[model samples]
Target: MRNYLIAGIAMAATFATTPAFAKDVIVQMKNQGAAGAMVFEPAFIQAMPGDTVKFVPTDKSHSAQTIAAMLPAGVAPVIGKPNQEMSIKVDKPGIYGIECKPHTSMGMVALIQVGKGPSANLGAARTVKLPPLAAKRMTPLLAKAR
Candidate 1:
């Protein structure tokens, strides 16, 4: 009985120390959504650090990737192949700019905010020049950032 109790306590401790609090937020890539054609179903996402953002390709010929100029300092870029599902684990608190490479000119872009606090890189990300259509689409999404 004592051995069983010790093992149960050990298991509880291990579970408590693990990163089980992280959750996955799914964003679907759609050819046509409420926003229009070639867009992520939810163009704006709010998540916490360590949370995973899963980009599901619900439509063909679409991809999800981070924009170079929109990343937080020291964070590596995350990119997905066209028509493939991709997941990004947001490890930092900031605004991450995502785009469908082929459709960016037509405004296929989205923004993910990792934390609730104001992001230090928000201003810079907003200023990163995008195609005319992407710029117009990003304006409202950026405004949704904390």
Candidate 2:
């Protein structure tokens, strides 16, 4: 009986200490022939809190910054330098607005929705002041949020 209890305790301890594998989503910044240099492949993503979003620069001079007003109440800020590969760990359940600072007017933007459904402030996020192009692009994407 004592050995069985010890074994059970050890098993529980092992599981508790194991680090959970995080799911990673890749967003590539590049230029299209006519579309110009403004977009994230797989522009719309649904990730769980704790998932990592990797913004890879395939073209030169692109940065990823999360608009503070676009995130949920408790989400930490995410800002990446231009032309660098930035990795963000999302631990908040809401909509995240990402944009390339330099190309925002040209419509380089993407959205990441964390959690299973639409966030509480979805309508407000859709109305945030964004660049003309970015705003236009998000209109349709926001409608498709789960």
Candidate 3:
């Protein structure tokens, strides 16, 4: 019983100091989803740094790419081909805006929040002038960052 207690304490300490495991989050691009037509299901994603976001094309003619003005500082731009799967690892803390190039006018967009820290580029992201429909869709997503 004494040996078991020591082992348990050691294990508890080990786990307490261990870093959180990175997670893989999936965002599906669909022509028709819970949100209606031309949408990325669960359009808003909250994640921590080091997590990976996988964009899966569930319908034809759907693609994923970063809105240059919404990109985080020091991070490379991500562009995904239509009907293809693309994965992006979140290494910095900020807000990232993703859109389906061909369908952006129809409001196919997604927002990724990496880390809980306030985004330094949120203002820049808000300044990007998207098409009417896309801007309307992004309004609420950006509101979540605050």
Tens-place lDDT digits, model 1, residues 1-146: 99999999999998865658889999999999998999997999998888999999998999999998998888899989989998999988999999999999999999999889699899999889999999999999999887
**What ordering of candidates by TM-score runs from best to worst?**
1, 3, 2
Candidate 2 residue 23 Cα shift, in angstroms, is: 0.6
| Among all candidates shown, the one with the greatest TM-score | 1
lDDT tens per residue, model 3, 1-146: 99999999999998765546788999999999988899998899998888889999989999899887897898999999989998998888899999999999999999998889588888888889999999999999999984
Off by over 4 Å in 3: 1-20
Q: In model 2, which range of ten residues has the least summed lDDT? A: 30-39
Extract clashing residue pairs from model 1.
Answer: none
Question: What's the best-to-worst order under lDDT?
Answer: 1, 3, 2
What TM-score does candidate 1 get on C-alpha atoms?
A: 0.87
| Candidate 1 wrongly placed segments (more than 4 Å) | 1-18
- Of candidate 3, the 10-residue stretch with the lowest lDDT total is 14-23
Query: lDDT values of the candidates?
Result: 0.92, 0.83, 0.90
lDDT measured at residue 92 in model 3 versus the true structure, 0 to 100:
86
